[model samples]
Target: MSDNQNLLAEQRRALILDEVRRRGGVRVNELTRKLNVSDMTVRRDLDALARQGVIEKVHGGAVPVVEASTHEPGFEAKSALELTAKEDIARAAAALVQPGSAIALSGGTTTFALAHHLVDVPELTVVTNSTRVADVFHTARQTAGAGGQRSGSPVVVLTGGVRTPSDSLVGPVADQAIRSLHFDVLFLGVHGISVEAGLSTPNIAEAETNRRFMRSARRVVVVADHTKWGTVGLSSFATLDAIDTLVTDSGLSEETRAEIAEHVPGLLVADRATSGSVPGNG
Candidate 1:
């Protein structure tokens, strides 16, 4: 494109970004009409902004990027933010679990969602430091027994430790317990995910505990939603290269997905339409 064209594109992207930040999100068709541009042009602008890390592209629109390095939201607070996306990601992550495999689930809203899906997997062993995650299984077992049915398998092991604002168990007790055990896979959840900071959390103790979980697991699968793409947290526990697979919702932009695909071995974009994962990278 020419210099004038480039300048016009920049100006249009700025306006597009402003709308996204103002409304919390913007649809492509709406932007096309507002900006008097073609649908393809609006998409291009959104893609550029997404690549710049200033905005996140959804299925047909864009939303402001969240970038908090030190701030940590509580479990209840985070749970209400992305309900649909979390469920989609959880489904994709759960598909990776085998019937009798051992797995570790870290604490966070997304991982907590995954816990509910694992309740019916037979002969599975789950070790988790999050009391909330463990309780999911415990509650399932209780409900099954009440119905006079065996909810066997998926034996839950809750680690002892201090709890964070996100309801994750951390500190020395959790770390020691995780270090001695091994798992087939780990479905980790994080406060943030970024190219520079990787998978991170605001709690230092939780970061350490997550590292122990990573070390004990043979394969690492990060279960995160699209909104986490540009966010950074205070303590980074693992880098993108360490992840064996990443399962996220389809709200992630193609540009962002390609960029992330370069770092991880596999990327699975969970689509609610199909209720399955679309492989980003083979």
Candidate 2:
């Protein structure tokens, strides 16, 4: 009877895993209802799955584990994670942009979200290593001109380099291109940010390319969600002190925020917005 119960539990947990993956997240109550199991049982199963590193337990439920130091997810894979938090971070970072000033943007889903917010900035010049970032402006420009009207889109300069899994252009070519140009500010979206590792990435070449981006900018601002705080990637790119500001969402606890604030010059938190057009300022 014990062996049979164990087998049944395994099958039930397998269903839970599938549901989490399909919906990106699942609430405990919903799981209990779906599995016709007690709440405690569902919670126990979630604990077991979390311990296996297959799922991450959140406030009231579980979500797919998208965290890793050495393993980097592809652009589309990352695009689905923390979407609302990304938008919040993006709005906060976009507030730092000054019209007519040249700014550099490193590649990441957060930075891609920021690109959308910057499309209408007049006289802005955007220097980026992400093809997706550039395409945002390109699409905006085309749309504005569809009716034979002038568009106030920013001038986008896309760096030349090999593409990474995250849709970022990195390598000697990208580094050289960045070396020749300078920006008023750089909005960097990193794979991880820790007190020890600082800003880091799994790709060495991308790390080097990011370094160049930093060197060419007068100020550096990091945009990341709360989940990125404790993560440490394989390659360290910049120290915490090197960044001028950090923009994150309210999901971060006060204690963690206080601790991080001690290291960086400025820390800005974006409250979750009701819609995508959240307003923020530097």
Candidate 3:
């Protein structure tokens, strides 16, 4: 195929994957009409994606691979899911940050969202293991400088370590960096939060790095959406009592909320409407 044809084919496959992810499944005829491509072209794209394990090609179309709760999705995939809930949780988590306070943020999609919400807060010393979170601050600073103001940018320290599939920096390097720092608060984003397991993650290296983050901070605040309620990952980071507070969305069930409250009394369930206010205790 020509270079132009190959590029078009790649773009078509991306669109197909996105559609499947959004709708849970997609039909070949639907893709053909939407992408304005031939039926054979759609089939070929789906077949290629299926070979790569991105999707499962059924009789006519494709379906997203069902990832287990213990399995960690890539940054883009996780970011696309629970967007509104993550934003609401992030807004509530951002409210906890005081000006000139030093904070440590663990790497996760929810914490990444928190970084965007925190750009306006001046004089913050943010130490994080996520390169994406660091980039957010960097972009904010550049944008501010371009607009003739550079003083509002926070000091972002990106820890050096091995990058994970979720775009988190982990391993010994990250742990050592976090150990040298002390923060007012540590906002953690985990793969799962349960009354029994507390905070859990899929990767052992990330779990260890998160442990260092918790110890480096005076207070530990967990930022997670409702979907993380009962799902447990491969490794546990912190238990229930170790967390000072939890900022989550209102989509969490009342029964689960009540149960979690027993363990964490300072749970803040963020309402989706009106900038997410924290209801006293769950």
- Highest-scoring model, TM-score: 1
Q: Which stretches of candidate 1 lie over 4 Å from their true place?
A: 1-68, 147-151
Provide the overall lDDT of each model, using Cα atoms, as 2-decimal numbers: 0.85, 0.84, 0.83
User: Model 1: per-residue lDDT, tens digit, 130-243?
Assistant: 889988988888887667536455788999999889888899999999989999999999877878899988888888999999999999999987767766789998899999
lDDT of 3 at 24: 82
The best candidate in terms of lDDT: 1
TM-scores, each model vs. reference: 0.79, 0.76, 0.75
Report model 1's TM-score to 2 decimal places: 0.79
Q: Is candidate 2 or candidate 3 better by lDDT?
A: 2
lDDT of candidate 3 over 49-129, digit per residue (tens): 777666898888888876564688789878876666788788888898999999988888999999999998988989999
lDDT per residue (tens digit) for residues 1-282 in model 2: 575586567557756776786578999999988889999999999998787666899999999887556798789978876666788788878888988899999999999999999988888989999999998988988887567424556888999999999999999999999999999999999998888899999999999999999999999999997767766788998999998888887656566677787788788887543433222223
lDDT of 1: 0.85
Measured with C-alpha atoms, the lDDT of residue 65 in candidate 3 is: 77
Error of 2 at 119 (Å): 0.5
Q: Which stretches of candidate 2 lie over 4 Å from their true place?
A: 1-68, 147-151, 273-282
Winner on TM-score between 1 and 2 is 1
Off by over 4 Å in 3: 1-70, 146-149, 280-282
Clashing pairs in 2: none
